[model samples]
Target: MANPAVMVLGATGRIGRLLQLCPPQGLHLRLQARRAQAGNSTGDWHIFDPRAEPAALARAAEGAAVLLCLAGPVPGRGGADADMADHVRLGEAAVRAGASAGARVLLASSAAVYGARGGLLAEDAALRPASAYGAAKAQMEARAAALGAELGVPVCSLRIGNIAGLDAALGGWRPGFTLDRFAGGRTPRRSYIGARTLAEVLAALLAAPVLPPVLNLAQPGAVEMGALLQAAGRPFAVRAAPAAAIPEVALDAARLQALLPAPLAAADPVQMAAEWALLEPEMAER
Candidate 1:
């Protein structure tokens, strides 16, 4: 039997770059991007703009066992309509392509779909998006699920939580950017997963024969902003916001944990921060 071919859209973003750096073994990766760059064309890369070339996108997904839709507009970068439209189109395209090829579609949805709701958020929680970005993701998830059911394609929406990256918990902190406190000067708690752990989970999901329709991807425990900042050895000041004003999403990842072979350890925010600090200088030199 041949290795399964996997297609990854938006193969140049932050998570995409991490996937490239630490690629999963035993799979043929077809990384797709909107445009070709100088150094990003080594592997099986296909440049197909979903906006311009719908056929090209389908072609890229053909003969693949899994189609991972990671392409979407960044929050705060464009108008709400434009951002929403971008993801809507991408989700539609992915469903059409995956249905045609009989490939399992995995859409990377955001935990922001739950809005500012505190407490344990399950996969079945009501979606009440606070921001435009959250609204767009909720719509995207709906569209993908509807299309998958209509077209008889296996589709899974992963509601991912805060991902700790190199610059996230370990880098230099700015006033408002790094420290976000809720009302009464309390640090908001949020579920987080390390970048490497996220990649590994994604790879495992790709290999699974059966998948749940929706699952929350997060670590076991939650982390606070103050703890993260202190772990990074950065001094920061917090501005108090209204109670429950700051969106703090904590996910219950029991479903995902059961799927994995071993226990998915909770991400230690401070440890991840320290590790990133150690790796920052080395990464910069490369």
Candidate 2:
């Protein structure tokens, strides 16, 4: 049998670049970038502008078995309202293109859709998004699901958790990003997945014969912010602070684990931090 043809939108984003780095075997990749770049020489490249040229999106999705919509407005580049609107628009376009091509659509969604909800949030949790970004994701998922049903195409929304990359996690902080704290003076717990693990899970999902309507893509266990910071060689400051009612955002990824071929081990924050420490210098030079 010929390798399955996979069309990937948002091929220049962080998740898209990771997919490029370790592409799945036995699959033909078709990558779509918003603008043409001179140096990229991998896969079938298409200059797709979902908003400006919907026809281009349909053309790129032709004869594909799976369409992964990883497209979204770059974070922190635009106002929250504008970005959210763009996400909804892009999602609608992606669903239309994939449905027209008779392909299963995978929407890369976010756990933020649950918003300020504490404990193990399952796929069926009510979406009460606390922020604009979270609300946007919720809207995207809803639109995709409705479009897929209307067009008779299978759609899966992967509600991904924190993609704690080497630098992003170890650097302690970044502009426009904040860590959550619980009311009891403890660091808020969050479900997190390493970048490599995230890529692997995505590959597995692409290959699965059956997919759930929604799945939480997170590691088995939650990580404490204090533990993670300490593991990254940073001081844990909120240890003695007064506790607030901040919600601990932990996802229950049991459904995802059941679909994978092998069982997933719980993530080790300290080990992950150590690995990132070693690779930080190397990543900086590139």
Candidate 3:
């Protein structure tokens, strides 16, 4: 099949940039930025300020088949109320516009959205979002699913676990940081996927002609903090800080692997970790 025109709502985010670096198989990446985020640009562009109107979304998403949302500074994410509002508004608008455009929506979710889990987490795991950011993501997933079902559109919710790579560099996870502390050697146990790996997964999902209501996008194995840090070639503590509340997340890689060109990405914490650290920096930094 020919590539699809995909409009990424959070085109400027860490994940979005990675997607830009090596876009999925069928994506004509169109960026959706707020008026403020949109200063100077050339090429196909769509201006969207979730705070303003959902109508603007349709214009931005015109002729697009897939809608990928990576927008807004979510609540409890080191931002002001206005920032939080942007997140909520963005979700609603994207849902509405996605349905209107008859587009498949990919809602980027986090395992953190599942709240505190005693063991490995799955797609059906109960969501007890401990933080406001998790709550927002949970809401977004629910709304996306509901809206898709109610309409003819299909939505894919990737309940991701801790993500390594550049998102870590951007401090996307803090206060309740996942990969860092894990990589730091603190919070000894953690599970995560590298940024490029995540981009590849999202690409596969977007490529699927049909999407299930929800899916889990994470590695098959969960590694310890010490190993993660060592893999990344960073220095960290063996155990997490006293206040840290870590959840053991389980990601079913079978589906993710099925879409891959070959074998699944590395599952060993040390090796996979090293791939991102030793190999990534030396080879694939861009």
Candidate 4:
């Protein structure tokens, strides 16, 4: 039998690029992008915006076991309202595409949805978004969940935590970068998942026969920002945390742990730093 096919929408973003380097084994990968990349001539890549081109999304989703929607407006490119609206449109398209085969639609959400909530948040926690981006994602989750129920399709919105290679602490590290030191003399901490580990989690979810409507995707514990920087051998300055700074955004991943076959990656800062460094050269070429 052929391997299950998994189509990744927005296959050229930060997480997507890392997945391209270390794709999951035993899954046939199909890619969707809004534009073409430099060295990709693979026939599996389809170029079109899912929000605008339903037919293209449908075509790309055919025969696929999962439609992973990673398409969204990154920070600074589009307004927060636009991000929420676009996700609703894309979610609708993905659900409709999978209506025939009942393919699982996994929508990429963010930890930003949790906002300034500073404790370990679970999948069922009440959303208390603190920023425009967080508000938009919270709204997006509600809309997408309702649409999935209406269409009778299995949809999961992954409230993803910070990805190691894509996060500000490691990926955004540069000389003279400033970090916030809280009154307790600690830096900001957040639940983080390595890019490669994320890919494996997605693959495992795709193969599973059952899934929840919502899930939190991250490692078991939160790692300190200062620790990540120190592990990467980067020097940085710290400033007193403003009153508005969130001390932590740790996620409760017990629900996720039950689903996976093995333990997730350690939340150790050095290990997370290595995960980020593994893709630097390839990321630079792209």
Most accurate candidate by TM-score: 4
For residues 1-286, could you state the per-residue lDDT of candidate 3 as single tens digits?
Answer: 6567898887766676667666676478887766534323543566667547677778878778988888867444554654444555666677778887888787777766777666666677778988777787788787767766777677777777666654342223234333434444444355577656677777777777876667777777775654555565565322334555553555556666665666455556665554455334422332
Task: Determine the C-alpha RMSD for candidate 1 after optimal superposition of all C-alphas.
Answer: 2.6
Give the lDDT ranking, best first. 4, 1, 2, 3
- Cα RMSD of predicted structure 3: 4.5
Q: Tens-digit lDDT track for model 4 on 26-59? A: 8887888888878668547889888888888888
Clashes of each: 0, 3, 7, 0
Which scores higher on lDDT, 3 or 4?
A: 4
Predicted structure 3: lDDT: 0.65
- Per-residue CA lDDT of model 2 for 1-286, tens digit only, reads 8899888988877778777766887788899898877556756889868778988888888899999988886446455545567778888888898878988989888888998887689999999887777888899999888988898888898898876663234444653444555566566677887766777888899988779889999888888766777777665344333343344788998999999999777977876576455544544432
Candidate 1: worst-modelled 10 consecutive residues by lDDT: 165-174
Give each model's whole-structure lDDT: 0.79, 0.77, 0.65, 0.82
lDDT of 2 at 218: 88
Per-model TM against the reference: 0.90, 0.87, 0.80, 0.94
At residue 5, candidate 2 shows an lDDT of 84
Quote the RMSD, in angstroms, for model 4.
Answer: 1.8
List candidate 4 stretches off by more than 4 Å: 77-84
Return the lDDT, model 2, position 19.
74
